[model samples]
Target: MLSGVSHTLRGLLDDLQAAANLRPGQMVVVGASSSEVQGQRIGTATSLAVGEAIVDTVLAWATELGLTVAFQCCEHLNRALVVSRSTAVARNLEEVSAVPVPGAGGAVAATAYFRLEDACLVRAVQADAGIDIGDTFIGMHLKPVVVPVRGRTRELGAAHVTMARTRPPLIGGARAVYDVETARQRLQGV
Candidate 1:
């Protein structure tokens, strides 16, 4: 189980980096459900312990890569995100009130809220990249022009994983000579 967690984390990092070209100080939104990852229904078997373990692993990796992370709450919070207050201000996001709980926000978001430094809830964020574990629907938080990312592991436990990155909208359709290398690089999982 631990090995599977590690592998999933590694693959997620690779896919995120490749898809978004996430640079230092960038924000990425994560929507997760530990229960789903542990082969349970999305919110049925919420586990703070599992959520903590996943958060610890992800935060370590994100810190090393110089990326900021925002954990998305479940539908109860209208899918609001939990992030550091600093990140909220930096990104010009609207801060909201309320702390996450397992029932209202899901265990994953609740765990993030507890772990983050000076955490705050935000109504929305135009995140540079996003990972959706168990199909929590993170598209609303991502920047425009969401491009899907296919990683080595399609599912983490029972949860299906999905990723997306934004790109500049291409105009002048037929005659446009897009940056082939950049497009290819993103598709190649860099």
Candidate 2:
């Protein structure tokens, strides 16, 4: 089980890098449910241990890549995001006052809150990319132009994995010709 989780996290990091061109210092929002990943209902089987393991794995990789991580809270916080205080200040996101409980923010978010340094909850953010685990719905946090990313690992345990990378909106019609190859190359981090 540990091996599987590690493999899934690696695949997710790779996909996010390749598909979103996630460079160093970029922010990525993740919405997850350990219960769903364990084949249980969304909030019914909340497990701090599972959440910590997942966060530890993912954060190790993100740290190596110099990327910032944001964990999305459950509906109890109105799906607000928990991120490092630096990220919130840099992004100019408004901080909200709230401590995440198991039932309130789900295990993953609560674990993130506990682990993060100077952690704070924000109402929203326009992240460069997003990862949705167990159908937690992170689309709203992603930038305006979202492009779907399919990783080698489709599912992480019982959770369905979905990824998205945002791009600038395409302008100019008809006579305007966009460089499709360049765009693809950019996405692949070439």
**TM-score leader:** 2
User: Per-residue CA lDDT of candidate 1, range 1-190, in tens?
Assistant: 7567767877777877887788898878899888888888788898787677677777887998999999999988999999999998888889988899988898888989988999999999888888888889999998888999888788877788998888878888875658989778878889
Q: What value of lDDT does candidate 2 attain over all alpha carbons?
A: 0.87
lDDT of each: 0.85, 0.87
- Clashing pairs in model 2, backbone N/Cα/C closer than 3 A: none
In model 2, the runs with Cα more than 4 Å from the true position are: 180-190
> Residues 1-190, candidate 2, lDDT per residue (tens digit)?
7567767877887888888888898889889898888889888899887788777877887898899988999988999999989999998999999988799998888989988899999999988888888899999899889999988886888888898989988889865547989768777999
- Model 1 is weakest, by summed lDDT over 10 consecutive residues, at 1-10
What TM-score fits each model?
Answer: 0.88, 0.90
